[model samples]
Target: MKLLYLSYLNSFKGLSREVWWLALVTLINRAGTMVIPFLSLYLTQDRGFSLEDVGTIMSCFGLGSLAGTWLGGKLTDRIGYYKVMVWSLFLTGVLFIWLQMLESFYAICSGIFVLMVIADSFRPATYVAMSAYSKHENKTRSVTLIRLAINLGFSAGPAIGGVIIASVGYFGLFWIDGVTCLLAALLLLLVLNPKKAKELDQVKNEAPRSAYSDYPYLLFIGAMVLLGLIFVQYFSTVPLFYSEMRSLSEVGIGLLLAMNGFIIFVFEMPLIKYLETSTLSRTSLMIIGLAMTTFSFFFLTIGTWTGLLVIGMILMTLGEMITFPFSSAFAMDRSRSGRQGEYMALYNIAFSISHIFAHNGGMVSIANFGYKSTWYLAMIIGVMGILLLYALRYRLQTSRKK
Candidate 1:
């Protein structure tokens, strides 16, 4: 038991100080991520918006995210990542507070769109920073550490968000979310002194390629979009499932969602560390991950037992644990020396596009066919993604041999 504990602790060794600081920044920012998880519910219950209206509003969030990531990528490539990160964090914090003042449907839609645009721009810049800070061998683990912070924050955020909503109302959510973003921004500026780390601004000597021109990468992005559509249901639809189907309360739903984060927080880093030693290609591991994620939806179809929720959440979390960090590392490795920002932007943008579909499509399907049918559709999508990934694997191997 002692040895086992030590080995798990050992997994965090050798990461650079900057990576740790970056994780701290991510942790603070994500810790207040109370708004998005509860956005659908807040719209329907608090604002009295129809499900269809909620879908439109959420789609706007996606569209804004798409624009933000693309802009962030270009800005990072041009102005450098430090300025991009700081500005994105600070501006997003202000917008989160300002978003609460909008009352009408169209106003809220526009607010959510602008808020997400500033908020999500932080993603690719952070990825570029991680690349700059981490040693080559530590890249995946570094990404995992960042993800661990994210999930750790997520684990706390929703549970706390539920309590906050119950106590202070949805209005309070915006304030807390806004404050945290500002805090995270300040922490980044104070701690990650870009002046000391001039390498962040250093030009890569290797030739740069446009991510748009990379064919295999485009296919990989497509597969991720499919995977993302399935995965994002947790944020958009699964909460409703707990409330309407299982009759769980807000707190109950929060705890259930937090369960996903807790499992990942505990298990993911160790899992990634172990996988780092394996001979299996990253694509093979991704296929395995996708299979688990697909089966999570399949688990939902089997029974209405609340136990199935826990089971499905576990499977989904595990699948993400395996899939995300390796995929990030894979994307980073695929990026040319100077174009990491563009490559990572497209990678994050794939999820943004998925958000556009996942919320609207999942909600519309539930309204029309019911939740069970939606799960079936998600499973089918997951299967198609798995096959696409398999094809990607074959193509990558053929290229290597050639």
Candidate 2:
């Protein structure tokens, strides 16, 4: 029986030791992301801030991420992934500790901006590491595994965070998050070193390509930005809608969000494999995903947690599972060997841009139009995403046939 168990482990052996280490590092880093899932609530409930203030603060984080994504990408190309990952992880840990000490709202907002910049800047390093470390045949699976690690951490973090917030308070959550980040940094510093470190200097000296030069890549990035705009509402407005508007408990809200992560964990891999062979192109999957996500919001307009709400959440997760990884894989496939960092960096930019719109515009929509109307607006955006994907599909197909 023990031999059988060991054999099972060896059968799924595409992940190298370095890749496993990176996954562990990702898990630890993401465990600290407990702060993000509940950040809006923390700002409003614990910190005694208004929704607008929360939106502004969150937008600052997004703005920082915008800069970080670009810088991290550029640096990854210049210095290689190892040094960038080590420093980024350590600096992000330091920022988290500093964030826990701030009492003033303005200070917290500023800290958030700086923290996001440092934290997000690490992503390109991580992705570049994954791209470099994994074999071509395993690339999609490797990226999915990395995301799986993140979602698994997310799954545990928020559920535990909710309990901690209810029992020991937000400071306890912050302390736990800080410790996890520190531990993650230490692990990365110890175990992983890029094999291509010697080539970094030569690569850095090479002329840079304009981000605009890759129009297809830019289109995909634009699609992701649109997706992020719609998706950010899950973090920003969904909790508010459930708690303030629909009158659900915090625990209930936490469970709903947890369900989202859990679904991703359970289905993402199998779904990815199934979709990999399907005639449905990446663009088509994205359109379907976005349409499902948009339609999911329609039930929210009714202000009831009927079976429809559960179904909507499932659809949203399914859409996400299809779109997000495929988008990343597509970008990586199109990128030049040395410019992987730049391509992934541009890809990460979508999330930051989305956060900016979602927090700022989403909050305003909720305040003025109420939860139902705001969902409708999100649905409209999702529809636009569908149209955008359809338009891009022809371009993608044409490129592939060449």
Question: Using lDDT as the measure, which candidate wins?
Answer: 1
Give the root-mean-square deviation of each candidate in angstroms: 3.0, 4.3
lDDT by residue for model 1 (307-383), tens: 88888888998999899998898887777444778999999999988877787789899999999999999999999
Q: How close is candidate 2 to the true structure, as a TM-score?
A: 0.83
lDDT of 2: 0.77
Error of 1 at 26 (Å): 0.9
In order of appearance, the predictions have TM-scores of: 0.88, 0.83
Model 1 TM-score, 2 decimals = 0.88
lDDT of 2 by residue, 164-278 (tens): 9999988887777778888888887777744422221122326656556877667777777888898988877888877876677888787887888888776677667667668
Off by over 4 Å in 1: 38-55, 102-105, 159-172, 198-206, 238-256, 303-309, 367-373
Q: Could you tell me the lDDT of residue 71 within candidate 1?
A: 87
Error of 1 at 288 (Å): 1.0
